[model samples]
Target chain A: MGEFELIRQYFMPLARLHGSSSVIVGPGDDCAVQRVPPGSDLVFSIDTLVEGVHFPVGYRPDYLGWRTLAVAASDLAAMGAEPSCFTLALTLPEADELWLRDFSLGLGNAAESFGLTLAGGDTTRGPLTLSVQVHGVVEQGGAIRRSGARAGDLVVVSGSLGDAGAALDYLPAQEDLDADDSAAADKQFVLERYHHPQPRLDLGKALRQFATAAIDVSDGLLADLNHILEASNVGASIELARIPVSPALVRLKGSAATDYALHSGDDYELCATISEASWVGAPAWLKQQLTVVGEIEPVSGLRLDGSAVVSGSEATGFDHFRRKA
Target chain B: MGEFELIRQYFMPLARLHGSSSVIVGPGDDCAVQRVPPGSDLVFSIDTLVEGVHFPVGYRPDYLGWRTLAVAASDLAAMGAEPSCFTLALTLPEADELWLRDFSLGLGNAAESFGLTLAGGDTTRGPLTLSVQVHGVVEQGGAIRRSGARAGDLVVVSGSLGDAGAALDYLPAQEDLDADDSAAADKQFVLERYHHPQPRLDLGKALRQFATAAIDVSDGLLADLNHILEASNVGASIELARIPVSPALVRLKGSAATDYALHSGDDYELCATISEASWVGAPAWLKQQLTVVGEIEPVSGLRLDGSAVVSGSEATGFDHFRRKA
Candidate 1:
């Protein structure tokens, strides 16, 4: 099918199913017109995933569709913004029918899960790359920023980390592994964690009233937290023992799980700093998913287990260009 | 340099130079936060241009940078929205410092010309591709859309058409031709037209009060106007002789200039439909830049010079995927 036909057959329906009322005009226009709620600020971020670089070649289209949107939405989750809408720019080598179908299905599922409207997008012919620009709304001046953390703020993280990083080792073996194999269940758990990592939108919204600073952990805990520290001009001391890791990841990597939790990327969990008073007063439901792993300090560096570590070091996290070296 | 350093060196400065007051949080965060003025609606669009597919390999990075942002901003013009901000997703095979410096210079220049803030974006390693998402604001309920054209509306277009299309022939020869060559000046003009086609932002914003429908002429006159026709459920009768063409293009293509004007893409001019009364009542400044090339009709197909033309026929315009076949 041609570009228009592909969009009509696969994407138009998805837009209709997931489009929000805020979308004054949806697809089929040069621009999508949307109404930002009165008194709300807008937050947006763009993310691109290139095949063979961001993901393995010939990865499942559905999982890719899910992964791309989830990854982009995680930025909104970090900003404590309510999900609103997004535009996708997808470049592909060919107009593959089945691929487009499955991709749109997964994308639609993600749009529904994240409560975003499909505003508009551009599809072009090229090497496979997907760029999603997600927009969200936050109360005026209520967006939690990385620069807001102050000394004495408690650094916390939502959900477990490092499963996606640990899952990397099992990706190539996924097809050959038997379902009844002893490691199959553990492998499946980590693989699912890799493929379908959830963006903490609800938790982010909840933190808006309480958190002093926030960031999404796509570049590993140490690297991403360094962003918060650098922006706020503060430091953090993370208790390595308090870092949470999924049982599946621990089972798969054992002693290496803590390292992955600290330095591996693509977890999509929100790492935020909250005032000690606010953390203590935060609702039980909110605190239940969060683990207080550290505290912000006046010193301007990252400390782990009482030792200062260099930020942006090779051991800190994944760097697209650095990986080449 | 890693992605962070590259962004800090090249992109962050551009963001600061073009950053609008509305941008609450700029680059270096998980998301950029911006305040949408109350009583206004948001307009956004995304466009991707891939190397080799969209432009020639080894094309001037600066021109590519300007062209990419201009092409994306054209969508905002089509919606009759005031330029606001944009995010860029840039992918590259390698970190070429000189290429990045020149590209960012061109991009920053365009951002200034179009009054757009560099919000935030992602950079990744891959084949070269740029996906720009532009956001704008329009008065509440005042966005001009393709669906609003009426049968009696007069079709109008701003500036000249087909120069960019005609310029394609000069691209490969740009380097070989001597500066003193007879056709050098004309080739230079057309090439500039291709590389720096102006988005009709002022024209679009002026049309917000009077235009029944509007679209940017990207995919040739016929193909793009047909979009307005289809969306508004109306037909059009275009006077072939009335379609404006640049003297440079006419000199280049002779009698074939008319065909190029009708069938070539990437003009970045605004094609709008307004009531006959509104067209007459429009200010002289607005009328000067526009040519009355056609009129909307009760029928549901396109007619050029009293003859019906198939909208998506191969002769009409360019289709990225269709070109492969």
Candidate 2:
């Protein structure tokens, strides 16, 4: 199919089903026009995922589509903004009808899940790469920034970490797992975490009233938290035992689970700093999903269990260029 | 350099220099936050350019930087929106410092020239590709849509066409042109048109109150105008001799200039349909940049000098997938 046919067959339905009323003009135009509600600030972010570099080559199209949008939407979650709309610029080697259908299905499902409208996009021929730019809105002056962490703030994270990182080990043999086998369930759990990690949008919205600083833990906990420290001119001391990990991760990696939680990336969980009083007063349901793993300090470095860890050093998370070379 | 350091050394300065006051938070944040003024609608579009596909391999990075942003921003212009801010997602095989510096310099110059602020972005490792998503603002309910053209509306286009497309013939030997040669200056002119095609922002803004519909000519005048016709459910009759062609293009292609003017892409000029009264009353400066090429009709297909030209059949413009393979 041609680019226009592909868009009409696969993406137009997705847009019609999940498109928001705020979208004045959706897909079939030079640009998508949207109405940002009064008293709101617009939040914008762009992320690119390339085959082999960001994901395994020939990865499942549905999962790839879901993961791509989920990854980009995490930035909006980090800013405590409500899900709004997104544009996708896709470069593919060919126009495979089946791939487009499955990918659009996955993307549409995720859009429905996140309440994001499909605004506009471009499709071109090239080596496979997907660039998604997400737009969201928060009440004016209500955005949480990385530069707001104060000394004595509690460093917190949503849900559990490390499962997605640990899942990398089983990815190559993922298709080999038998559904009826005893260990298959745990493997499937981690695989799901890797392929469909949910953005902590709800947790972030709750933290808007309480959190001092926030970031999504895409580059592992240590590295992403250090960003907040550097931006806010503060330090952090993380208790190694307090870091949370899933049962599936522990079952797969055993003693290495803690290491994964500390240094591996792509969890998509929100890492935030909040004052003790605010954390204590936060809703019971909100506190149930969070774990206080560290505390901000006056000094300007990162520490684990009272031992200093240099920023951007050995324990720092994924750097696309450095890690590759 | 690693991705973070690369961003800091190159892109951060661009953000600081062209950063808009509306941008509450710029680069380094998970998502850039910006305040939209009350009573305005947001307009968005995304475009991707891939090395060896969209442009030749080893293309100049500075021109690539400027062209990428300009191509995306043309959508905003077509929507008659004021320039605002944009996010870039860049994928490269390696981190070349000199390329980054020159590319950022060119990008910064374009940002300053177009009144766009650098917001946030992502850098990843892959085959070289750049995706730009631009955001602009228009008065509430003021965006001109492609579906609004009336049967009597005059088909108008801004500036000349086909110089950029014809420039491709001289691209491989672009560096061989000597200043003292007689034909060198004309070759250089078309090359410049190819490298730095301006988005008709001023003309588009003025078109808001007068135009019934508008689109930017990225995929040949016939193909793009066909889009407006299809959306508006109307037909058009063009005067073959009235199509505009640049002097530089005419000098190079002579008798073939009209074909390039009608069917070439990447000129990035605005095409709109307006009532005859509005066309007559338009400001002289605006009128000077535009030419009356045709008129919309109640029929359902395009015609050239009363001869039928089937839409999406023979005269259709560039299709990335279809044209490639």
Candidate 3:
């Protein structure tokens, strides 16, 4: 599709929305104009999901749209930024009406659910790639960062992980968790995670009130958390038993089972560090919604109950560019 | 390089620049947080430059870094917003240190050249793609939108067009430019426009004082300007004889006596419209530096004399996605 007509059809309408005072100008100009509240900081992040790479190709457009936006917003959750606005850059092969309609509906639902406005975006025809620029606001000086995790911090996670990764084992078109969901609870859990992964904005904002360091478990618990540890230049000995294994995940044994949660890349759960001297209890919302998985330490290198954990590329976690034939 | 090292070596240092107050929270987080002035609004836009799409494959990393940022900043320029900060989602196949060093330098130079600072970004192992998210600010209720152009408005352009399109004949390498660059002036001018485009942030902000509507000339003079006409529900007659042609472009088009400037893309110049009543002379910085290319009308459809523009599948000018053969 020509850029003009495609943009006019999909984005022009998104631009005309119920105006908010904070949104000085919405999707039509060179930039989406927004106002950070008096005591807030504007938080921004950019992510690109390439076709045949980030997501399986020929996947349902609606799910793809929901997942793409959700994946980008999860970063805000990781940083404890309250969602406000987002801009999407969509590059597709053509303006397939069916796909565009479903995708738009999916995006609309996500935007509505997160209370964010589709502020601005660009539509182009390319190799079916989607890049999302998401914005949120944290209190003037309260946004949590990966580098803030120091030694003696308590590491925790929002909700369970690995279900999205597990969902990949099912058929690609299996959009619903219940449809063809095997008796395997783990399988169902994985499918659910894939279909509707949650962004823990509530838990993240609560952490801004109490936690020290945080990150979303996108790459994996070990790999992603290792980033925090590396940034903080320290590590911890996790109580292997403290790991919150979902019922589906707990059933699997050996490398494959643990690999799903440890290195599977789609989980967007937040992996955060709390101050040892901070309050002993979490907010009720977080408590009902999250699981305490591990604690930070003064040591270097990741470990499970004082033992180091091994990584299996399983061809799952490595960068696709360098992947060998 | 791995993602972490790329951040530490290429991005973190740039993000640490305590330039303006907009950079409240920089890199080292899931998102970059900035502070918008009390009476100001945040302006943002996202654009992606893909290899073999936006630019020729095997193009110089330095120029790639520069042009990508320039194009995205041009959007800010169109909206009359002041450059504040930017985030980049860089996807590359392998860890090419030398290339990355040059790319980072170009990006850093561009960031510092404009008032914008490098806030935060994502570097992943994938196809060679650059997604830049640009942030700017406009005073409360002071920004330009395409929909603002109306009947009886003067259509204007900031600079000469088509220099970039001509330069593209020398693709992927700088050698092709050597044969064409018999004269020093011609050679340097062609290379400059192609490699390092100027984002007219100053003129864009200045337009807020005198222009009725504005947009950056990205796709082409005919296409991008038509965007204004379509949005304003008005048409315009542009004098092809009055179209501004760069010195290098004039020399290159001497044989064909062609006016590729009317249809060529990648100019990054600002195209605007001003009402006859609101029309005032542009600032000195703009008068000698910018061009008043044409005017607007009350009818619809873009025209180059008597011809109507048609969409296509070309990879360069106006190529949303050039299909692979």
Candidate 4:
């Protein structure tokens, strides 16, 4: 089948079930038209994942589809924006029906899970790559930002860290975890965490009410949290004991678990700051999701366990072009 | 410098100038937050230009950047939407400062020309590729669509067609064009047409009031007009003599100018259908921009000068995957 025909048969049907009131026009148009909610500011972000660079070359098409949306949507979570619609630009080496079908299914599932409508996109032929641009809405001037943190604010993170980073070791093995091994279950847990990161949309929404500053942890805790400090013009003192390290990470890295949590990337957890008063007023569910990892300070540099987290190899996160650094 | 630093130094400067009231939060945050004008619908589209596939592998970075945004913005023009903001997902093999600077300058020029703001985007490492997602705004329920053409509607096009397509042959010999040669000047004009297409945004917005249906002629005139026929479930009788072929194309292709105008792709002109009453009432300047190419008919297929434009090879435009077909 031709490129347009394939998209019509596989991708167009995926746009059918997800109905949003804001959408005026969906697929099969030069551009998709939708209304931004009244009294809201539309938030948009774009991310690209190239095969062999971002993910495994022959990774599961369904998983890649889900991950592509989830990773991009994590930025919306960071901005505390409500999911609205998204466009997907898929470039493939060839038109493989089976691969396209699986990828479309996963894309549909991600859109449904995130409450995002498939507005419009383009399908082209090239090296396998996916670029997704997500649009969401937040109340005007209400988006959580990295520049809002202040001294005396508590830094908190949702869920555990290090699990996704640790999963890198087992991702290539894919469905080949030895069922008899003692760490198989833990390996599976981390692998799933790495492959299908659940963007903390609900938590992000709740934080918009009280969080002082927010950033999603995609490039490890130290790297991402540093962004907040740099933007907010404040230093931070992170308590080593407070960093959340998953059991899976401990199983994989043991004494090196802290390294994975602090230095490895692709962990889609929210690292945010909350004033002490706001933390006290937070609901039980939100409190349960958040774990205090650090405190904002008046100084101008980051500290880990009261010692400076020196820059260079020790502190830098994922730098795509400067890989050797 | 790392990717982040490169973006901060180069792209961030481009983001500083285009201040729009619609922007609540711009490029620095996880997402760019903007407000669509009160009574308007948001229209968005994405396009990717891959190395060696869409353009020559080592084409001028400035031209690449400009063409990228122009191609994406053409979709907005086709939808009769006003430019708002755009996010760029740029993947590269390395962090080359000179290339990025020139590219960002071209991007800034395009955004400024189109009255668009640079929002949030991701920069990553991979094969050189660019994915641009443009967001525009149109009055709610006012967007032009291909499906809206009626049997008695007149088919019209904005600007001349096929110059860009015809320029493809001379693109490789760009620097060798002799200034003294008449054909060389024509070649230069078509080459500029190919490299820096001016997306007809103003013309599109003007047509929203009168045009029943619209599409950008990206994949040749005959091919794109066929899309209108398919979507409106109507047929068309196009006058070969009426097809707007540029003087440059006629100079280059001679007798085959008609073929280039009909069969070649990347024209980026708007093909719109207008009611007879609306056509009569259209402003003088708009009338000057638009040319009568055909008339929509009650039947369900396309005709060229009283002969059927056969399906398959004779009718098909550029298909990404089935390039040879």
lDDT of 2 by residue, A34-83 (tens): 88889998888999999988888889999998999999999999999998
lDDT: worst 10-residue window of model 2 chain B: B13-22
CAPRI level of candidate 3:
medium
Higher-DockQ candidate of 3 and 4: 4
Candidate 2 lDDT over residue span B1-325, tens digit each: 5678888899987677653457789998899987878999988899999888788889899998899989988998899999888888999888999999989988888887888888888999889999998888999999889999999999999888888888887888888887788778788988898899899887889899999999999988999999999999999999988999877778888889988878877779999999999988988988898999999999989899999887862358578886631
Candidate 4 structure quality by residue, lDDT tens digits, A9-70: 88886676665546778888888888888898888889899888889889999999899999
> Cα miss at B202, model 3 (Å)?
1.9
Write down the worst ten-residue block by lDDT for model 3 chain B.
Answer: B308-317
DockQ, candidate 4, vs. native dimer: 0.72
lDDT per residue, candidate 3, A1-325, as tens digits?
5555556576555544445636667765667778778878888888887767777778778878788888989999988888888888787768787788788878777777776788877776557778888888988878888888777778887767676777777746464546454545656667668866778777788888777888888777887887788777878666656666677765644346666777665768898887756736655666666666677777777887777755222222444455331
Candidate 4 per-residue lDDT over residues B1-325, each given as its tens digit? 7777789888886666566546667787788888888888888899998888889878999998899999999999999999888889999988899999999989889988998888778898888889998888888889999899998999998888888888888888897888888788899889999999999999999999999999998888878888888888888999999999887788789889988888776768899999999999888989999999899999878888999977432346788776531
By the lDDT metric, which is better: model 1 or model 3?
Answer: 1
Q: How does each model score on TM-score?
A: 0.97, 0.98, 0.89, 0.97
lDDT of prediction 3: 0.74
Q: What is candidate 3's CA lDDT for residue B178? A: 55
* Candidate 3, pairs of clashing residues: A125-B320, A186-A248, B1-B95, B155-B295, B235-B299
Encode model 1's per-residue lDDT on B23-97: one tens digit a residue.
Answer: 878888889987878888888899999998888888899999899999999999999999988899999998899
